[model samples]
Every structure is written in structure tokens, then in C-alpha cells.
Target chain A: MNRLVLQAQILELTAIRYTPAGLPALDLVLKHESQVDEAGAHRKVALEIKAVAIGDVVRRVQALGLAGCSVFTGFLSAQKQGRGTVFHITGLES
Target chain B: MNRLVLQAQILELTAIRYTPAGLPALDLVLKHESQVDEAGAHRKVALEIKAVAIGDVVRRVQALGLAGCSVFTGFLSAQKQGRGTVFHITGLES
Candidate 1:
């Protein structure tokens, strides 16, 4: 089980494109900032993550127009050799 | 809100260390592999992530001896500029 739930603003967006399978896809860069409890202490945390939405989720994200924050639930996967990881968003809660 | 729950194997472990504040800390590289549902299809996912555990959590991770898989619950935070993101694990389930 691999899941990531995050509330982040759309920092940047790439044009909607199609996968080799012809599925609509949208790529995004997300900025997340919040205070988190860790090791019995609260720490300020910030992250910039690479994420993508495919199929139906792509259109919803495009409609949102990168204007606001949304909570995204997704799975993480490695992109390719030496490319780091990417978040694959499956659900969105605005 | 930002949270990530992932089941991964401990791929590599760093020597137990202490923070400047004297809190025990441990660094790890985690490898995650699984089949995930996304966009109405099952896709194979694999990731190698950098993670850290501090304070009490550090001891527990060290005792586990870098063997087997565990489910880790954490938050993502960016490292220094251009260094990518790190996972701050707060809870572990063996």
C-alpha cells in the first residue's frame, strides 16, 4: 500500500497531453506548506513535489486552472533511472 | 495537511547519529514496489525514497536492523535548495 495525501497549491502546470495509451494526462508541480507533528514536536514543513493526473482527473485539474489549493490522494512511483520519483494523483478534494 | 503512508523495504541505513540539539536520528533509503490502481487501471509502482526518523523513532528503526518491510507514515518536506524532498517518518508498522 502506497498512498500520499497532501494539500498543496499548483505552483506550475504543463499542457495537457496524451499518454501512449491515448489517456489524457496533465503534469504539475505542487508546493506544500504546513506544520506537522513529528517526534513529539511540531515542525514547519514545506515541499515542492512533481505530480501528474491522468484520464478523468486531468480535465478536472485543467478546469481548476491552477488557481487554488487542493488535497490530492495519490501513489508515488519512480520515474526512471536517475530521474527521482513522481506522484500519481488519483483523487482530488478541492 | 500532508501525509504519506507507504509500505517499503529498508534498502540502506545510515549510522545512528545525533542532531545539533542532541536528538537521536537515523537516515534511510527506502524501496517501495507494488501494484496500484490509477485511472481505472492497475499499474506497477516502484520508488526509492530518502527518509529520516528522529528521537524515539530512531531507536526503533535501528533495532529493526535494516531487514524486512514496514509501513511508514510520514510527511514530505524539501531538503535544501535543489536537493529534492525528504520523507520525515513519524510512525512505523512492521
Candidate 2:
């Protein structure tokens, strides 16, 4: 079995490009459906985050918040175009 | 217990600002150390990819690769500044 890890639930999301002032703009949207942890019961959370890296993108993501998640890295043996890393998320509607 | 997913391995990295050619510049670097699968024997891969999102970033990440992995979304109740979503990953050199 592949070595897996623990990730939480994803919720509603929105993204915005970072501005000169510094705050990132929320310009993206996503459909969510995942599992999460509440006070006690194992309630499913709403949104999830997932990404890939080969250079510093991954590390940058982690530095942002390396908490509970199962990140992955892979390559397209086909095109070989997407070298470095390719990540995704689980949970969410799927 | 929080709901989690199956992430893969992360690898070495190198990023550069995208060019006119239209390749998102890979301008970053990261460490590797994780697990993977090959035919049968359970082998730990040597890389992991992780990231966070809010707005269009998360959707962008997933649109890239919506595979087997545990992604999460959360908020820093403290700041409320990092609202929208915050994701991270495991399987890396935590």
C-alpha cells in the first residue's frame, strides 16, 4: 500500500491574486465535500487543498500551513512535460 | 478522527518564473522524502507535494490533478485574515 497521511475536510473556497498592498485576491471557486474533525464527533469538513511541487512551490505551500493532509508528487511518463511534481487532493465532491 | 486521503511522494524541485513560451515559471525549491508503489512491494517514494488554497488557487491545483490524496481547508480563527481556506500536507520531511 502507498504510504498515506491524515488530511482534514475542505470547505468553500475563493482565491485572489496577491496585490501590491500584500493581500491575495480570492479569484477562484471550488465545489467541496470532504471529512473533517469537530469538537468530538468525526464530522466531515467542507473544502480541501491540494497542490504539486518540484521546485519551491511545495515547500512554499507547506510553509503556509503544513498541517493535516496527504500531498503527493508524480510525473506524466507520457508527455514528460510535467516534470518536477504534480499533486492533488481527496475528499471534496468526487 | 479527521478524514484523510492518500497522497503520494514529493521529489526534488527547481522553479523559474514562467516565460513568454507559456510555461508557468518554476521558481522554487523543496526537499523530498516520502513513499510510493511499484508493481507490488510497498515502497516509500522519495517525494511529496503539498499546498494550500483560497479563491481560485485551490481549484487551480485540483484542476491540475484531482487524484488520490487527502486535501483540507481551514481558517485561522485567530486572524480571520487568512480566511477562505488554508491547506497543508503530510508525507514530507515534517
Candidate 3:
């Protein structure tokens, strides 16, 4: 199974604008400590994920009749060691 | 001279409980990448700092009559790139 991961803090879970095409969005305030972006920058950046991935994970969970609300607290991270980037997914928040 | 640095996101600057002793507290939601604490493990953790150091930074600013509200966005970091945690302070948020 393919998976994607992001490294950031769960700043706030406040609601975002309900887009004209999809459900409401979420505003995530995140930071970076040592990793550099495509711009070769060394700093923290805040990005927003308007639409949560409703792919494999979402589909599988929905099939099991499990609520997606629980995934809201999962912190994502993209870690780069000597070579290669690994997607690290944290365990579901209790 | 003494200095302290923290690495985390600005999460929410909402007003915190006004202790009968001080002004207000700022809640920070931060994360870690590869560094390990005293326990000797690899994982991420979130910590909070209340009652910001109103020391040299605050004292020096108060001398020039500059408002301290500006420093609210400064992100602190305790990075262990190779060894020895170095105190890194971000430039004032412009």
C-alpha cells in the first residue's frame, strides 16, 4: 500500500472555509527544524491541507464503519537521513 | 549571560489563564525530528513554555520603549545536528 506522510505540529483544529467544491478545510500551523525545502531554504513554513486524503486509508476505514474524526490528531513527518526520504506515520492519538 | 531556545510552532496565540502572579501565558505546539531526550530514544514530543523570559530580550527592549508583542512570533530551537544541543533563536518576525 502506498502512503504519504508530513512532519508538522497540530497547531489548531479550527474550521476553515467551506470551499465551493468540497467540504470544509483545515488550517495547520507547522514548523521545520533541520530539513530544507525545494528552495534550499532552512526555515519553518506553514501550509494548509484543505482536503484530507480520502484515498486508501479513508476508504478502508469508511468501509469498516469507523469514524475519520480519530485521524485528526495523527502527526505526519517526512524524514531524510543519509539518503532517501521516509514517510513516518505516528500511531493514532488516544 | 544565559540563553534558552525552544523549537515549536506558534499554534494559537490565544490568551491563557492569567495567573495571579504574571501577565499571560502563550501555548506552543511544537515537534521534534531525530533528536532524543534524556531517555535515549528516537521520537517526537510536544512541550509548552509559560511566562516567556522577560529577561535580557525583554529588558533590553523595554529600555528602548519597544513593544514586546513583536517577539511573540520568534521560534526557538534546541538542535542536535551532530552533538551538543546548540541554542538557536530565530530572527524577530518581520
Q: Per-prediction TM-score, please?
A: 0.95, 0.22, 0.20
**Tens-digit lDDT track of model 3 for A1-94:** 1112333344333334443444333333323233422112354433322212222233332322312323322322322323112222222232
Number of colliding residue pairs in each model: 0, 43, 7
Q: What is the TM-score of each candidate's chain B when compared with the real chain B?
A: 0.93, 0.24, 0.28
Q: Tens digits of per-residue lDDT for model 2 on A41-83?
A: 2434444333322222323333334232332322211112432
Clashes by residue pair, model 3: A6-A76, A6-A77, A7-A76, A7-A77, B6-B76, B6-B77, B7-B76
lDDT of each: 0.86, 0.29, 0.29
Q: In model 2, what lDDT does residue A29 have?
A: 19
For residue B12, model 1's alpha carbon misses the true position, in angstroms, by 0.6
Task: List runs of model 1 lying over 4 Å from the truth.
Answer: none
Error of 3 at B4 (Å): 1.7
Q: In terms of DockQ, which candidate is stronger, 1 or 3? A: 1
Poorly placed runs, candidate 2 (over 4 Å): A5-32, A35-80, A83-94, B1-30, B35-37, B42-44, B52-94
Write down the lDDT that model 1 would get: 0.86
Model 1, A29-48: lDDT tens digits are 98899999887888899888
